[model samples]
Target: MASKERKTPLIRVKNLYKVFGPNAGKVLQQVKEGKSKDDILAETGHTVGLSDINMDIYPGEIFVVMGLSGSGKSTLIRHFNRLIDPTAGVIEVEGSDVMSFDDKALQQFRRHKMSMVFQRFGLMPHRSVLDNIGYGLQIQGVAKQEREKLARYWLETVGLDGYDKHFPANLSGGQQQRVGLARALCTDADILLMDEAFSALDPLIRSEMQDQLIELQEKLHKTIVFITHDLDEALRLGDRIAILRDGVLVQQGEPVDILLHPADDYVEAFVKDVNRARALTVETVMKPQVCRISAETIGEALAEMRKSKDDYGYYINEDGYQGVITQETLEGVEQSEYDKAIDPSLLDSVPAVHTDALLEAVIPETLDSEHPLPVINADGDVEGRLSRSTLAEVLSDQAGSEEDDEKVKKLKTSKSLAA
Candidate 1:
């Protein structure tokens, strides 16, 4: 018989609980025995830091925990590397239960398998930038010369080249954050826990740091759990966002899906002000259909568009489909005394996007460009035209569909009970 395959999560938290109070231990004992939330609350009068939290973080995924203050986002992330002990739960990393590890084992796990960056730049005040970055390696007993070399490499990675001799006090907020990031990454830790690493920076520096994180993630692909209170920051950087409210996981998914179809009123309120049109893209809205164009008269082009019931007409060329002329283009057209500069290359103005790109990623270019963008296949062939209204309608319909589904589910449950 083939052995049963066990799919191990990179990081797993099962029935995690953390309570803060004099009777916290007793309350957590009740929680472990599967007591009701109210019973556990009443028994210990303990504040639940994290309540029965369950999550599986995949390898190489940027998993973000988002919540307001005191929502347990930081508490949950800390439980992963055992920076803070959970009152009740099994925390697993690489198929090993970290919560079960002895002090020596836990220390080795943190030193080798994980690294953390905090909101405050935790660099040593007396140490040089290089020493601060390599501090983790030094703790692990790496040779001084080797640790220095690794620190230099990390400084370059974080775009802090030629600042190896400077102390933490000499750096700006952004530079300090970069040093913090470099220090965390210098360990080459398989798992990274970042607790609001950019929260202390100015708005401009925060945005810049976010961009740097994106760039670094692309290159390193380390499994990361980032905690942040800013939804926009979560949306900008997370591969998947886990939203928390009052120590409960409200919802979790990709940014576009969450924005377009929130799970409840809480989520909707969070996303209400977002520009759906700008957040969604041509690829998200475009229908997959055979789009054809004629190499004949403008009348033939118009006829083809009318026949296809398409808003735009694709212009075919010997090389391939060259450009698209929409009704808007034709409406904007004017006759000129001088022969219009009809560069055949005008067709290239149409922006093309891959199917995998999030609608939000494609919107800014389309909205800012002179011409409408075409949805393209992997081969760069025109798939469909994406207009502003089309993208807007898609978002509206998606939101409506989610609401409709919820109503349908409720009705079914009510009917079942009535019967």
Candidate 2:
């Protein structure tokens, strides 16, 4: 994804630090003075849950906070809605300080502005799927008829229309999570906070739920704060990912950025086992080597290819890439009339892939053909070329070099220094 139009953050967490023990707030000074989570714990018996955590969650984006067990991923998410109060920090939603809200204001905020989906599905076993989905609306004191109608609409939205009367116990894990998701949506809140929402499902069911959230995001554009430990899940769902270790933010960035340029050894280790084939796209390794030949004749096309030092070139009109003219095609038309229009029949078939296509998908095409696969964008325009060599390099475990790591470290250092 190229740079999009900048939008102000819908939620901001500033200097957020959470300490979980009796004397939690008392350790603020030690925690802020560059003390490690373990050090703070050993000295004060207060476990550092989050340390100097800051984030600007933009609207209509899935911002993922992920870490291993006890990394405070869940702890950090809870502070967003004041489910757990920070030891010392600020949480703001739409310019309103979360900590400043009174009991009534907080209740109203939770009901109207945000909804949560939990790891356990958090459904009432006694209630029907329809009742479970509408539970948030029921809490809001909405009329029974209207809440049921809204719940039914979301029931169908999450692909569980006929099973409305069924209880949570009757459904599979995937279906139950869909009910949780539909429950969150029924509130019509601007923000959705999902804390390990799909972590309980089987591999296939997990993947299915991930796909569902992505599809729903495309249409609804809710400001989502998703928590997950699975790298694949985070990469697939998060617009941006923040990696945590022992409650400290190790790195935060786009999936490609994190994969190609990890911030630290901790982050590096976490991502080393990630499946790059599925994570990387053709655009990442593609070169801008499309030799455009606007020629009237085969001679002109041959001249263009010679000048570019390429064995083949594509005939491009305003419409887009037409066809390939290889050296073989040129030799066959060497004696043709120099001024005659190039015969389309003589052109060689060129393999092509979309820019967003994964490297794994394009690797087969590269293996099958000798020519570079033209990378086409959404507008049917040739953006670049994906060669076999480039694909090989990307697939290699050492896809990034030591020099690349250095550059990334310097970049992160500079950012930290500036901050």
Candidate 3:
């Protein structure tokens, strides 16, 4: 993670507001007074496109803006490129105010500083694959040979090799979108603005495109502002997500944080259907475990267990977590053998889960094992232990919270009726 103080933000939007229709500025007072979107529209004949939206986008992060239709997700991304003017507030890119830019400066910014990939795969039907990919560079006045060279490289990078001579009309929807991605990438801009880039594709193809984008991001690390209406897509791709509702900023945070702690009922409703078992990692539910050494005798291991008050403990070595040791093994050993190293054959063969492993994967391993599941880091060192009880407890807490929220709502309604 980049230090906030040391690293400057790539993009910053503050108290941004956009309203459509004439005299849109006149509706600001109504918005400040907490009037609803529908009320403002009925009285003022203006539609609120965005409301007091503020967020900082860090470099090399995929920042996702998502909402249902008319939620202003598409409207919000347009502010980044100054494609749509905000009725109020600040939009700064790299410390410069984008709203203050002259036409010439704005043109330069769009041409060189950033690129957009539209949902429609905005490729000219008359242009060949190579021509479409090289279009951006050509517009920048690069020589024909040089532009084609860069275009061909990105074409192969996007897995569209040997299709350079083909036209957009000849390609499938997925392939056409790849051309659009290649074109934007060909510009080599520091920032990318993707507006529902994969929403038009079929389910399987959309998933494949998402994987491709993730793979490309690992290598390129460009700062991206992706717009989407799909919750699954946002969770899969967003480094940080900002959800909008009726032009208002609802919540914004890492996917895991948003999943674990929704800010309000609206945000909770959005995440309620998510597969928590598959979404949460082992680290979320793991507990600290008492560790024992492989060379230790049964008596020594038993002593450690008694001290920790744990029924069993894990045997660890320099290489990594070995297996589980039980109280029975410690007690069954002969008096003479009690001081010897615990037998490896008698080890419980506990299954280990990586820190990044989802709880869904941990379920089967823990169901049959008597000992707590060992959670290991990438390097195979045991970090903590997870048990079925702990898993159930975390899940129950989530369900209980929802139930509690319903109770609160009912109480509020009852009080209102009494009053």
Candidate achieving higher lDDT, 1 or 3:
3
> lDDT by residue for model 3 over 1-419, one digit each (tens)?
11224257889999999989888888887787789999999988899999999999999889899989999999999989998999999999999999999999999999999999999999999999999999999989999999999999999999999999999999999999999999999999999999999999999989999999999998998999999998888888888899999999999988877887899998888888876666677876688865655556777777776666666778886667778887777777777776777667868898898987877666666655666788888788888888656655454433344234443334334322223
Clashing pairs in 2: none
Q: State the lDDT of candidate 2 residue by residue for 108-132, as single tens digits.
A: 9999999999999999999999999
Candidate 1 residues lying further than 4 Å off, grouped into runs, are 1-8, 29-43, 277-286, 289-321, 324-372, 377-385, 394-419
Candidate 1, clashing residue pairs? 279-360, 280-359, 281-359
- Candidate order by decreasing lDDT: 2, 3, 1
Q: After superposition, how far is residue 322 of candidate 1 from its true place, in Å?
A: 2.8
- TM-scores for every candidate against the unseen true structure: 0.75, 0.88, 0.87
The TM-score measured for candidate 1 stands at 0.75
**TM-score winner among the candidates?**
2
**Model 2 segments more than 4 A misplaced:** 1-5, 295-311, 326-336, 400-419
